[model samples]
Target: MDITQTTSVATQAAASSADKSAAAISSDFETFLKMMTAQIENQDPLDPIDSADYAVQLATFSSVEQQVKTNDLLTALGTQMGGVGLTQAAQWVGMEARVAAPVKFSGDPITLSPNPVAAADEVNLIVKNSQGVEVQRQPISVSNETIEWSGVDRSGTPFVEDTYSFYIESKENGQVLATSTVEAYGQVTEARSQNGGTILVLAGGSEVDMASISAVRRVD
Candidate 1:
């Protein structure tokens, strides 16, 4: 990932290319070994190159060869993972998704979708703040329906421009009933791997970790 490592990789790639281009490189490798052995065998009686020095070069070459192979395998695995993410992206096309985003206050009532499985009979929406404090609560009639928020706080004060969270609940006979789920909806712009997992980035500048996905649909 550093400059020196990148340069080393480039150098190794050039070496690999050269080795492949020289079709008889394996025979050449054997020839060099034989020549070295023959020279040592015929060396003068008084002077000889150190056999230990040749042994060191052989060891270094072996390590470098293995490293080049490892790099190639890793590059191949990355390509495979990218292909898998593309296949998964096609699964989320037409399904209605409930993404958690604050409804922009335009004086229009906010509408929530896909009612809770627990208490879908009498639905209610609870708005919470960043601190998880319930700032507003309103009773609604449908679980899988949408309700607009006027951006007003519990005391009927117009809320400021900031992010908020909402939870849909169902209550019957003054008792809690069920809870609904919320999901974000958008086209998958791209899929990428991060921290060993794939993430799908949607059209609204929001990112969804693949593990968080609950449903998928195909659309034209």
Candidate 2:
């Protein structure tokens, strides 16, 4: 169904699998111990099993048990971490975040953080739509500053409210100096976990990984 529903199902399935695995391991261990006891009891009196062999078997069993316990603990820890992630995600719901990824332009002016190369004499901000088509381009200062886009095309015509990406090109005397990294500020509308990681769903349907967020601030 929806992403949130899918994530919930996945989490439940993982917890169930962990529980089943722990149960199976415990059951198998009990069977193994019983089998070993039967072997020792039915051993020949004159040709008894070597004490060294018994010790080795016991050691192996202990190792397996320890490994199973470790797995159980790790599984529990993962579940706990997932809960903590959800709690943190809930806190991000109404806050603005600067993420190192493309952003959605919803007719409102969006702020972009651009980092220009140290030696660059000129910097330009390139705006691209979801289809990777350049819609607007403008010169910017060669400094680490935030630029705002009015969601308009070159002709001053406003672009339809939708998701758009941005890129920054730094040049020095017509030669390309660097293509700097761009960060977009957006509001987090929702959050979901997929593939063992948290993803923030922003306004205008853009999604970004929680780890990709560089900064967070109140949406005043």
Residue 119 in candidate 2, Cα distance off native in Å: 1.9
Candidates in order have lDDT scores of 0.58, 0.82
lDDT of 2 by residue, 59-160 (tens): 998898788778877876786577567668868998988986667776789888998888899999988887888887799888887878788776789998
Name model 2 segments beyond 4 Å from true.
1-18, 41-45
**Candidate 2: lDDT over CA atoms?**
0.82
Q: Tell me, by TM-score, which candidate is best.
A: 2
TM-score of 1: 0.45
Top lDDT prediction, candidate number: 2
Q: Ten residues in a row with the worst lDDT in model 2?
A: 1-10
Per residue, candidate 1 scores C-alpha lDDT tens digits across 1-220 of 5323433554465556656644444665677689878888998879877879789867876676666666656655554554465455545543333455432333434435545655346667777754567777777666454555666766778865444567777677667776544542334555555655666665444576777765544423
Error of 2 at 220 (Å): 2.4
**Residue 191 lDDT (model 1):** 59
